[model samples]
Target: MKDAAFNQLTHARRYFEAKSAVYDENARGWYGRLTDALLSQALDLSVFSRLPDGFRFLDVGGGAGRWTERIATANPESSGVLLDVSPGMVRHAERRATRCGYAHRVRHINGDVDEAGELLAGMTFDLIINTHHLLGFFHSPDLVLGSIVPLLTDHGLMVSVLPSRWHAAFGDLSVGDAERARRSLSGLSWEAHEAPYGHLFTPGEVRMLHTSSKLTVDLLTGFPCLIYPDPPGVASPSAESAEDFLRDDTFFREVLAMETELLIDPDAGARGANLFVVASRVQPAEA
Candidate 1:
């Protein structure tokens, strides 16, 4: 299992390295925009208001430094470090920061999160952002959270975006297609339809992972309740077709609005396309 995991990570790194040059352009479609908006909302609700000036920020698997750039601009007094396993991605992020004149405020590291302790020796952060379903790449959530928990300050927080297992199984089913939805759900598990490195998780599994790492879950919310078509699955849409579908600004805006509203209910996480979790270091008991 360990060998397989390593091989998967290696393959993923190579794949991303090849995609690095065109990643930003490829991600400029409607789905990408919607995901960004949802994540921005999550960050605003969970971390932005409570963020202290001059706090240290860490972005795990922060490909191309997009989110890091946003965080840096939002918190000008704060410093940030962006880490990714792909060197190509690290270079892209570096270039992006230089272009945005934030090079001085952000440091880019090309390393795996599993070995973050050595890569980030003697460093502790106040805020850690791990979006884009980064946790899915690790062999185990415990390994990922274990490395992260020790790197956070006593009051530090980690915000992670995870793919929802329930959504993976049924989110694409037609609203009234009870038969199909039931069939899909019956076969679904935490490991169903897993990619070479990515893994989906249920809400309960997410909570367990955090608790095992000595972290406390502060919030777990759903995002983008309804955006894609049903039956084939959310990942079924091709990028070109998705872009074409979003060309109608009016339709896009309307759907975005509806999805945003649906995300408000806490139970939405149980069936949404993705989940955002905010966890903080476990506080010690006072004598």
Candidate 2:
């Protein structure tokens, strides 16, 4: 399964680079019709309240620098690092950072999250973020998290976005669509197929992965917050439509937002497409 998944990511990266132009164009279209839905909600601000001014943030498995841009844009005073395992994607992110006016506040690094090397070694941040359904990159998220203790500043918050165990819809595939996507995913990049399709972590699983003496869950809930892709690999929407779609339809935006609220509420019945986790560093428990 690991090998299958890795090859999937490799394929996804190649596919994206081959079609980056079209992919970026179509994504702008989708977001044009749907950005409002994706942006309506806010993070539980408490996570940032305790964070000192001019906070520093590290985006784990962060590529295309999209999430880093968002965070930097939302918090202008913040400086950020866009870390990813893909050099090509890192370059894409660098371009995006320049375009988004976050070039000065951001740095891009290409490396695996599991490696505690010079790139990430001795670095600490007030905030950490991992988005686009990235929790599956590690076969053992707990251990992946264990290594983070030394890299987090006091009161640091780690926000990880992952696919919800219970979500609104699974594309309602007709006949073989689901199977087709499943098979197509096997040869895609891990970034493309990691979450929103390939692997789903339940709320329980979310709690478990980040459970540590170093931190405690500040928030864990389902959010249809992202109209992005299920398996975010080569299959994700293009940048153009991503911007275009959300801007085009109010009803489309409203419903996704309304649905997200329900998924986060206690009686949400099930879950949504993904879970948003905000965990804070905690002092170790007594021995």
Q: List the residue pairs that clash in candidate 1.
A: 172-230, 172-231
In the range 34-135, model 2's lDDT, one tens digit per residue, is: 332333353533355666779999887776776677778878898978877667778888888888888998889877665534677777898877775555
Q: What is the lDDT of candidate 1?
A: 0.75
Give the TM-score comparing model 1 with the true structure, all chains together: 0.83
- The lDDT leader among the candidates is 1
Name the 10 consecutive residues with the lowest summed lDDT in model 2: 187-196
Maximum-TM-score candidate: 1
- The number of clashing residue pairs in each candidate reads 2, 55
* Candidate no. 2 TM-score: 0.70
**TM-score for each predicted model, relative to the true structure:** 0.83, 0.70
For model 1, residues 71-100, the per-residue Cα lDDT tens digits are 988778889799998898999999989988
